[model samples]
Target: MVSLTRISEYVAQTANIIGGVLELDVLIVDRSLRIIGDSDLASVSEEECIRKDSILAKVMAEKEQIILSSKEHNAGCASCLQRNLCMVEMIIGIPIFFESKILGSIGIIANTLYDKEKMINNQENYLKFIDRMIELLTNRLKEEQALEEISLLKKRMEVVLDSIDDFLVLVSRDGEILQTNLNFKNIFKRKKPKYLNEVLCADVVDQLLNDSEEVKFKEVKVNKIHDFLLSSKPVIVDQKDHGALLSFKSIKDVAVEMNELYTHSMDVVFDDLVGESPQINMVKERIKQIASSSSTVLIDGETGTGKEVIARLIHNTSTRSNAPFVAINCSAIPEDLMESELFGYEEGAFSGAKKGGKIGKFQLASGGTIFLDEIGEMALHLQSKLLRVLQERQVNKIGGLESTEVDVRILAATNKRLEDLVKQGRFREDLYYRLKVIPITSPPLRERKDDIRLLVDYFISYYASRIGKDINGISDNAMGILMEHPWKGNVRELRNVIEFSINMSTGDMITQTSLPFDLVHPTQEYDEDLNIEVVTQRLIEKALIKYGDSTIAKEMAAKSLGISVATLYRKMKELDLKNSIG
Candidate 1:
């Protein structure tokens, strides 16, 4: 049984390729005698399908490979002149095939050179390959159509079984278990079987079905059966009742049932993000401004600083929130497959490519956000092609003749310093400018001590629910230790530490003892803290001497030093530098 869809599609494509090679139209049809695939540039009509003079119909009826020529067929058949006027006017000859037994016929119409034996051999090989495919498709269709009918029958049987207090089972005439709903497994402590091999109805009545007195069908297995009052009825579909279907549930039973249930939740939201300090606030504000615009965003940050999360937030908050937010880890994707993963490839494009071809991430994320995480790891050669896509807004698949127009918003993230990369001539400077139209940096956890309390409390609650425990908040000492520690891995590391402590701690409050060994243990502090007043005075004096005193503002000096202006002003006051202020 060759799959009609695939066979028809291939036949159509081959017809076109052969048609192009020889100059003609191509058509493919299925067994229901309907045209399923057509490669003709000219339009076709539905009624043209049943025309007796058509090459496809002749191929199906004759059960042989064919090459139909307009010159010969129209002159021979009476009904063919009209068909010639309607179809195959330009077709000098086309290959039509009857590939398999019981599988639908495929007719490829082409005005091409006739190499009949070779073309027929190709069709036979294709048919053999698609035999299993057609069977699977046909079986799936049968199951789908039967689903609704079977579901209704099961519901009707539920009431009859509810009246009984014990397990019930119904086996077939051949002693094969045909139907078992969720109830029998629960009541009798029987695992719902993957398949029923030799279970019969009579065996079930004697062994599993409770209340022999309640049984209404006298024979248990009858030639022609109908409904019996307050008892199971024969399940029917399209006037034919399938094997016995019985339903029974128990009020109390333990089957030791367990399943690995999984839930996929998008737990990361913009509000879950920590950081209110000014250094981070400026970046957040800039992200907010740029998120609304359709410009390409390049997020630069150190590893584990939540670049991907920030990228997600921008996508979730933007105008395209309803559309897909597809993320591709550029570094993780293999270099050899990266091209196909981005631009997709056509059927028979390369060895091992799927027959019908694949749709790429770009096509999948059309009109949505595509997050290219770890983009600095993208290959240099691919970077040039990527730049072309950003500029062109379209992509051509591998071996595909046409380009598909895409309107995808790019939001690329990287932990690598791209500016340094561009300066070193590793990354294209043009692409850098294209992506850096808006850049957002997530402040590392150590940079914002004030927000540590909020983050700790959040993680405490989060981890508690996750591990199925309810613990009290962190103590002041634990909080102090947390704030004192430098978070190299940022918030991600902090969350892990909290989770570990919560798992280890039995008491309500997270004490210093419960904290990880690294944090709980003390280390020597940096002894030589620089003189703030002297350092700021010298810095501001130097800047003012060159740029002029009035031009060099307190805010400018503080920013240049990568320190707080408040700290700088405090230093200015201590050094008597305010006396020189306007």
Candidate 2:
């Protein structure tokens, strides 16, 4: 569908040139026989449509040249509808061809007898001249088509570049700025720089242009002091370096991506802390009051008292909830590796450092919160570093030349008394005060005994559904035993006890026998008037009844009674109770 109208200006100029040189009028029509070019408009109207049976239409249909003379009464023009009105004495119509496909037809008409005689005498020369004009027109059309396709491709490329979130720039091998995307333009709020050195520092520009290989994740400042993670690759075409493509991603945005990748248990919200006691309610209120602030929090509690749970609740309700919540156990990691792990390290900083270096927990938790569990166990030297980081809101990586600014909220938890550690010179006093900007205490389960029933129900429902059991409730005797036992391990221990009971139960309810052996037969308290011999005899009888008389059963009984198998056998023989075995 390459139409002659697309190059109408060229076609018109060529028609006029032919008319001036040969003293003959010319007309050019497209594939549909629509008149698009005319040299002498006085003879044929510019909008005239050629008749299908005309000599020019016949030439186009046959894809060949046709010559007719008025005096010869040519049969080709005999069928023309306007034969009487035709003013031509002689004419030559030739089909314009490109790549074996006819695009249109060009008609050269001789109106006067002098012109007609001139054309007839030099017929071979005239045909050759017109064929050359057709060649020029086809070449012009090809150039126009190429320009059209290039324009379309450029528009598509712009759309793709604008959709990217990162700032993008295209540079030449000489470091001249060739192009930039919309993000780059918006950030700088000005026209693109003429050269890479105009925006990036000289050293960065040198690395980008001369590297010949891709540069990845190089932290650099652009337009003076804006931090970015810059990546660049040389643009190569046909084994020759053309230029390079540079992409700059904002460091804050990168932090969010890393947070999403590493942070876990994102669903731990305030409601997940299941408790309803005066102490627990007061703690909840305090969390709600202070969650909006960015001050450091020190949570003090015994083991299994849900200190980490309170920290997560505070974080989930804070302004940084949408960001990361990184948790690290200070005691779990070795003292040798704690510094590098918390603050990160650069390439070659140590004997076994990663090639590209590593981002620290603080950087990953930027615009978020970081929880340090068992902070009292951190080394004294590390405590000094941690205090400096808290004071300055910055982190100096291992072997790094400069410190990086961070915007992370610190939350440290310890079961031990940090004050006593400071008194003993085991922990830094200044660091201890710095960490406790806001102090929180997680109450043990013994203090919140009223929540025991609710916690038990919650755990039973949770573990029953997970283990696919049909447990309904605990028997009154079992409940009394749980309530009277001192929960030294707190809520975590209670949850474990409930899970154990559900697994051990065969019926819908958790009876006394369904509980663990230790829970069912706790050691009794003796008074001053109690007889030690009588008490020992009754304990042995009860143990034998509960456990069978087999060897394994006796071993279990002896273990439960806090004695060895031989000691239990000697005591039974001395007490004359050997006949008691079933």
Candidate 3:
């Protein structure tokens, strides 16, 4: 609703002009019948100026003009209770209308006989002048309302632009900086530049202004120092170029986003290794000591000895844990594509290359760690390129002229010894030494037999929960079979065995009957000394040596031997093995 008070000043000025020209008092009242403008000091107060029975009120109610000469006989003022107080002999009232709605009324009053005669003689001209004044006041109010709405819309647009995370700028077609978002202002310390060239290079600005389609470029230098990924889209309206909207993302931020997109949700932490043996503890301590370093690491171990697990643990415990931990199995990918897979490739590098090129594991692992498993399997030609990357801390994409700098920590694992491979001319000596800056060896399960019990308990609980079973523990007979079997496949093989046993077991406990057939009944040669007593004595002696001669050791040895501690003690006493301790 448009209020007449919004144009109160214009109403006052219009009333003064008409009153001065016609030599009569003028008064203006709003739609609510409240006087808002008065040309002369009226004897009546503002609240009492307009009455229900006044001529001005009748004109507004009827949405028309009214002219009266005699206040006592005019029908427009006959019912006015305050008509006696009104000092007027003639009156002209015109109602203001806008959009078919009456906003207010304008009245011309004649207090003297000469003024009354003057108004009655020129009543037509007086109405015409007041009508023109109403039109001007209505137009003024519309303009003010439009300006207010535009201001509100501009504020809303600014808020929307500032909410973006990336630095954004609106520029003219001639590269003039028009407006910028909050991120851009923050980066520049709230000091706005005059043109795009003040922040971006001339060539980049040129490409943004001239390109018809959306333009995107990475590693673009900002202010000749910092690198950013820039993208621009021309603002086209009705087949005319207005300007361009540019967005800048930090290269480091882009790398982090890519890492998140490419990373898996394995959630492998340092504690997930789950071992208490000396060999395993030593490996864990070594990882903790060097977790903050950025040097290259070389891990050598037998297959299934948890080399990749150790690498992941190191990454998880390091400062770069929040970033990506990319693992590439050299033996898994083909040798022909190993180079491209390691160092990325250009769009047209090879015959069947992907259209937009592909980012390699190293690039994806930037600002974090990359593990190269089975490094010995990498070809000699690729080794040279790998050496160059390690030496320069940069990578050259295939069929690309420039090298891209990478801030990645390299970690390589192999089941075979790189030293022996280098001696055999299969691996480069320089590259081997470079990778061995921090060498670690993952101990096989056989060497860390002390951790077997813990590993068994962990795997049992894990597999049982995963398979939704109630199996709680492994029986002595089942554990004895596992302790005696040599695990050539190490932890991986042990895990599979436990999973198989859990699946095969029908009861709440895993027993020897649930074991694999080949594991429970292995082929054995006939013994030359077939005496039962001698065999039993020899087995007891061996168990005593393997475990200590303490009472707890005897209990553990008895469990491994698939016997009770009391039976083992009885046999020891019968065999006269007196070296046992309580």
Candidate 4:
């Protein structure tokens, strides 16, 4: 039986399409006697039911077709309570039926009284057209109901099999998959297959189907790293083999169960992140919210700002922390070899390919996190391929026929501005949206100057212990100089400065004298009133003091100052510093 709701939905869908076909307005009344669909954008509400004396109500009660023309109706119009109020010039309402039971009706209305008179004069042709349309709607409703039933049955079986312990798949005698569970789909990385060989190897299918004797359980390697115990048994129906039931249990899962006694520890924690700034704190909170979900993350920050460190921290705090963490630098790799390096290559993919083929960073990072640094450097052509892999959750190796499905989490970082790249048409806009699902920007050092003192003290102690120096702390003058520097290279540059000062220190405390010459004798703006020679002399003196007596250093200093080493040496000699250097 066709449901009233289903019949109403079919009417609404057909409303607009049928207007051009019949060149007349159409209205649908479902079994509930409610006006369901109207093509003319009519004033009547779809929720309203037909009144008892309306022409439509009488036709539905009588289970017959009624034609209303400009002229009076034969008998129905006499009894219709709405005859006075109904402005409809002409209408044809016919009862739709299924298995001899009245279901609903379709009504086609004429545009004007003249049109109504003309339609009534050629009533037979209009009836035939209306009858044909009703027949099509009835058949379509039956087909939709049948499909709905099949879908419900499939969902019920999936739920039942998914609750079972083992990974299960049912196949027909001809090696067609009859049913499979989510675990089976996830483990094999395949969907419902028409042929068993689509999900399993051809050899495995042939062996299982052809063997008449009891099939013994066997160990088989499914992917590169996982091994599973596979077994098949005949599904009997009335003493005849109908199909086979296949099941598997992974060896690694069993090992993990037994090793549950061992303690597992994460590689990173909130404490490992040094800064107490609000910006860093807010970032940590965001990581906590999104880390568990399997969404792609984009880390945006300048170079040497520890983007990879954020990636690692997110992975360590995630559920997949037990798995490996693999990283690839997109800008570091050569353009020609990038595809093969990222997606892997089959053996002999190219002349110098590795023997037995190599797994890509994506495949290696399965069940873990893969960090793609400098993702903005990926080429446009490769960006399209990467988008496909992310969409399908599968990778096709270079020179390889089969595609492998991966369960890896993606964490990408870039020093470049990707949105600007998108506007420049150098990056794929779709791929940009895909990677920035959870965008995080590491704070630059200049913006978070409050953390500088803590970072400086930490690095001083860190490098001091590493270099076996007795340096206990930084002097007030050295600390003052550090706070004033621009720190163009961020934290990484700060660490380098501390390391250099520690090596040059001659006392327990790091002082101004032990600092690099560039820091100790930093450049200062000269007075505008000074003469050209005075300004020139002052610039020469700073360079000579910074580079000292080293020829290579002086040469580099002179070149940076846009002068020749000979000129710098002459100036130093004129200043009476030549003998002081010797």
Candidate that would win on lDDT: 2
- Residue 209, candidate 1: C-alpha displacement in angstroms: 51
How do these models rank on TM-score, best leading? 2, 3, 4, 1
- TM-score for each of the candidates: 0.46, 0.76, 0.72, 0.47
Give the per-residue lDDT digits (tens) of candidate 4, residues 266-345: 25677656687887877788889987888999999877777877888898889887776777889999988889888888
lDDT of each: 0.61, 0.85, 0.83, 0.76
Give stretches of model 3 more than 4 Å off: 1-150, 261-264, 334-364, 398-404, 496-507, 510-582
Worst 10 residues of 3 by lDDT: 41-50
For residue 155, what is the lDDT in candidate 2? 89
Which stretches in model 2 have alpha-carbon errors above 4 Å?
A: 14-23, 40-85, 96-102, 117-136, 459-489, 492-582
lDDT, candidate 3, equals 0.83
Cand. 3 TM to true fold: 0.72
**Highest TM-score among the candidates is held by which one?**
2
**Residue-wise lDDT of candidate 2 within 313-337, one digit each (tens)?**
8998999998888889999999999
Q: For model 1, what is the error of residue 560's alpha carbon versus the real structure, in angstroms, after optimal superposition? A: 12
Provide the lowest-lDDT 10-residue window in model 1: 251-260
lDDT of 3 at 222: 71
lDDT by residue for model 1 over 272-304, one digit each (tens)?
Answer: 676677866776677678767778888877677
